[model samples]
Target: MEESQLERNRRNGFLALVLRPINWLKMLGEEVHWSFVIGVMIVYGISQGFAVGMSKVSTMYYMKDEQKVQPSELQVYLGLLQLPWVIKPLWGLLTDTLPVLGYRRRPYFIFAGFLSVTSMLALSIQRNLSLAFSLLSLIGVSAGIAIAVVAIDACVTQNSISHPSLAGDMQSLCGFSSSIGALAGYSLSGFLVHLVGPKAHVDSIPSAARLYCFFSSFYPLHNLSGVTLTSQGVFGLLSVPAGLVILVGMMLKESRVHKFTHRGVNEKFLDAGKAMWTALKFRDVWRPCLYMYLSLAVSLNIHEGMFYWYTDAKGGPSFSQHGLFASKNSNLSLITYHEISSWLNSDSELGCSDVLFWYGMQEVVGSIFSVGAVGSLSGVLIYQNWLKDHRFRDLLFWSQLLYGASGLLDLILVLRLNLKIGLPDYFFVVIDEAISMMIGRIKWQPLLVLSSKLCPAGIEGTFFALLMSIDHVGLLSSTWVGGLLLKFLKVTRTQFDNLWVAILIRSLMRIIPVFLLFLIPRSDPNLSILPEEMLKMKKGDNTLESENTEMVSLVDST
Candidate 1:
């Protein structure tokens, strides 16, 4: 009886541990009254997840498998696609400064959703590589997903100024929702990509014509069966999130005051331009922004291209030993694909799709059970419970250092050093991903918290958008630089001889940002300045002047 009771107690403890984060989010949602802020976040989170998953699967697998595009060339296209995100400050300016039909947020949200849906649909049917690239880039631009996200963030930041205790909790909820969405999307993406074979194989029709036919009619009608899911069909299904974004835009309630501004369009644009200039002039805001940019600028991600090359290389260990273990062990079947079409193709050349499949498996497992999910959750908890009081700069430095350390695992794998220690490629990837994800969460949460605190009054959305855009610039630059490095090193699908050189350069680059930590604030702004004190600080700020009267009127009306 006592043993049974102990077992029951253990089970209860496990359940409590699992449900704690969910409960926290529930409490936060109720406290926030499930307002537009929370609603926007949830919808945006899911949409962002779906978009990221779609991009990853399509680029890494479909493009490689179908188009036979080399890694170097693909990287170039990926970098080009980031242009919209890099220029996101323009979107911020337009959304914040210009109102459509007297509504700033709603109309933009609707337009963005419409664009995203249309872009995804176009991607489904288009067989031309140039057109596909253009559509993908259009998705990044028109999705205005970032616009919605930044707007919600601005609302949260404004609310946080008044309710200081809820600031961290609200940010936690945002991260939690985003993580959930990403995990779900990633899981579904793997399944979808696997279901849709890497390249469409039509015996009768030419590949291009068949692709058009599948996307135009066959996919939508669900005519294809068993291991014949078309890429266009998957893309068609992926459009559902954009539809949800449109629904959210139409249904979400916003303040009527947000509907009308006393200023003329010219005045609004002038004020926005001034607001951006004033915000950048502030040491507190632009300092962190500069730091984030520099840190990201110096960071190298050449390892990503290298990893793909390593996996797909014809003579590589992963390639040579692909079927050896699976042939001997029945248990291996549980982890890998079951269908014969999944592993075999007519050409008999080792297909890149198989490598992508296993990689997806690693990603799904790591995202759900191993590191990405658990680590991200724990990151929020750890920050809230133990590290919230600590210096933000110190925490960021440590987290980034740990993140760089995680890259060493990739280096080890690239060097085939893991094989010497009897670590299979699969285990190394899964473990490395788990660790990297956990550290990544730790690194990212503080950055978001800092960005939230840095938003000045009156122009919170515009300023936050600028900050995010700057961050994207860093990412965009990194992607472009990584692609350049691959091209320079001549790292291709077959030739990875110089891959380690690129990896070494990236590893060294990751540590350069650590030395530049002086740019980040040493203290948490929310705690450092009391709410009343913050109001005092804002009194002399010019950017807050244009909207002050309207905000005051809105407050009085409420």
Candidate 2:
């Protein structure tokens, strides 16, 4: 009887370990509000996931293969696309202060959906790089999805004041929903690239225009498989989610205050401007903003640029017949080719399409079993369970350090150091991506938590938007600076002799931001308004009410 019991216990324990993630997800689902979960799913899943996925793959191959643009030149155009995100304060201001047809959030949501659909449709049909850049920027403006996210987040944050525990649960939902969206996008992007293959070259301008028109109107069937999966088809499919977003927007029920504020459009604009100005003048608000900007500006991300060059470059670890080459400079020397070639052998060079296909496969496998998904899920669980009591500053510092350390994997892969231990190139690539993504997700949770704590009541959307915009600017700056570094180092598709130097510089730069941790506040993660601050906000609300009453009286008298 004892032996039978022990055997049964071991079997149950093994099954539990296998099903732990599903159980965690179920627990999380029960903890969060259903409406919040649904809102995040729609906003992140369809809008952010589908649109971003299609754009990334399409833009990358379109420029690299069709236009034959260099990595540095391509990064500049990508940076230009980030302009809409950088000026997100304007969107926040418009939505916060101004009402459209007696609604603040719904109208913008509809506009964003429509704009996204049109821009994506245009991108699918148009092959002009310049035109593509313009469309990309326009899509950025149609980011009504973000507005919806901000509005929902504000609601959750307000509720958290009374229910402190709800804050972490909601943040977890946001991160989890976002990861789901990203995984879907990442998986589809590569598949689409493989399906579309490469854009054909045309002799005349008119002929190219005609070709685009044909593709726009109808997808050409693939000769080998007799399947229709043109670039236009893929983009058109992506636009369906945007259409769904518009439907969701149309169905949203606005609050009474949102409807009440509808009486004064112009007045709301002035009020919004004033509110933004006031928020900016506050030391607490501006200090974090300044710190985030400065830290992001100095932080380097040449790794992405270098990765592209390394993968596509001939004679690199992935393709070079003679594994690793010795660098004349001691700083560049790491691992030898012979050491790597023992387990990993490169037979041939990979074309652009081949590279994209491999990436897609990696994304697909990574989505299913990668540390990224596991780590993201784990992060939410850890924060909600164990780390909720920990200080934001301390969590952020440690996570950032781990994230920076993950950068070393890129260097190892570049130098074929992983192969020394009998790991295949593809295995190393997947592992590196998983580790980096896991740490990256861990780092993201605290920022969202902190942002929720920092937002004031009245201008929550605008303030959060401003904070998110600053974060995006940091990302954009990284891309732009990385491009410049790549160009300056002469790290091209065929040339990567100085790639190590750029990677080393980026790694060192990642560490510098850790020292500036003093800029962040060490207060409670659930920091809410003090009694005095709440009183001030109540008075401001009263003043607004009085002003509206006076205006109504004047209108009635007239």
- Best prediction by TM-score: 1
Best by lDDT: 1
Residue 363 of model 1, lDDT score: 27
lDDT of every model, 2 decimals:
0.59, 0.58
Off by over 4 Å in 1: 1-19, 36-41, 128-142, 194-230, 258-263, 317-385, 528-558
Cα lDDT tens digits for candidate 1, 1-558: 999999999999999999986786677656555453346454546677545545454445555555667776776666666666666666666666666765556666677777777777776767654746754644453345665565465567666655666777767667766666665565465456545534433333223221101121123111121222235656667677777666666754454434345465566667667756866777776788898888777776564475465447653443212321133223343222223333343454543322321222322322333235555556766776776666778888888888777777777877889889988766676677667767777777777777777765666666667777788788777877887898899888778888878877886788887888888877753562323333332333223332311111111211
Q: What is candidate 1's local distance difference test score?
A: 0.59
Question: lDDT score, residue 518, model 1?
Answer: 87
Give the worst 10-residue stretch by lDDT in candidate 2. Answer: 546-555
Name the Cα RMSD for model 1: 7.3
For residues 470-545, write the lDDT of model 2, one tens digit per residue.
9889888988998899899997767787887877787778777688778777777765522336213333432222
